[model samples]
Target: MTQKAKSRQEIAEEFGISAKTLSRWILKEKLQIPQGLISPKDQELIYEKFGKAISK
Candidate 1:
């Protein structure tokens, strides 16, 4: 089965951050993330750099 792609907002939500903050973080870190749905590889890199989102 194919996995559903995740959007920036979804990722930000997962990280407990706002989409704007995620954008800032990406800029600060100089990550080469594309617009729209995030790829699996980029997702992994994001998690690695920022760590997994904390569950409440």
Candidate 2:
């Protein structure tokens, strides 16, 4: 038996944030939180689109 990968909501819960907030960060490329929480691919995608983080 093997465990399935967690969903976005599950990931957000682990980080103590809401799924919507997580989506916002990912979609808008605003990663203002701590490191090691986000995947490298996501980081690269965000950086590629937004250049840098623009916190709100």
Candidate 3:
């Protein structure tokens, strides 16, 4: 199963947070974020660290 890559903004909105906050979290955790989109692996890591995005 392949997961589509997501943009930082998309992920942040899903998590009910600002992209800036997400950046802070990423920096705090020292996670690597790709240039354009968040890879499936990194997306999973974010989901694990911060629960999956809130259901709309």
Candidate 4:
């Protein structure tokens, strides 16, 4: 499956987190956001970490 790249706003909404928090995660290296934009691999990793919480 080809996953689409998502913007910071999209990721924040899908993860149920604030964009500011997402940005902080990126800055802190808690989340590995790729240079320029968020890639599919990055999205998958983020989902693997937070998907369950957001799904509930």
> Which candidate comes out best when scored by TM-score?
1
Clashing residue pairs for model 2:
none
After superposition, the stretches of candidate 2 with alpha carbons farther than 4 Å from their true spots are 1-4, 30-56
Give the deviation of candidate 1 from the true structure as CA RMSD.
2.9
TM-score computed on alpha carbons, candidate 4 = 0.63
RMSD for each of the candidates: 2.9, 10.5, 1.7, 3.1
Give candidate 3 regions above 4 Å deviation.
none
For model 2 the local lDDT of residue 21 reads 77
Reference-based TM-score, model 3: 0.83
Better of 3 and 4 by TM-score: 3
lDDT by residue (tens digit), candidate 2, 12-54:
5655678787678665755554444455455445445545433
Q: What would the TM-score be for candidate 2 when compared with the true structure?
A: 0.44
Can you write out model 3's per-residue Cα lDDT over 1-56, one digit (the tens) per residue? 22789888988999888999999998899877766788888898888888777745
Q: Tens-digit lDDT track for model 4 on 1-56?
A: 22687677777876688888878766776765766668878777766765633432
lDDT score at residue 12, model 1, on the 0-100 scale: 92
Q: Candidate 3 at 28: error in angstroms?
A: 0.8
Q: lDDT values of the candidates?
A: 0.84, 0.53, 0.84, 0.69
Pairs that clash in candidate 4: none
Question: In model 1, which range of ten residues has the least summed lDDT?
Answer: 1-10
Per-residue CA lDDT of model 1 for 1-56, tens digit only, reads 11567888888998888999998999899999999898888887788899887634
TM-score for each of the candidates:
0.84, 0.44, 0.83, 0.63
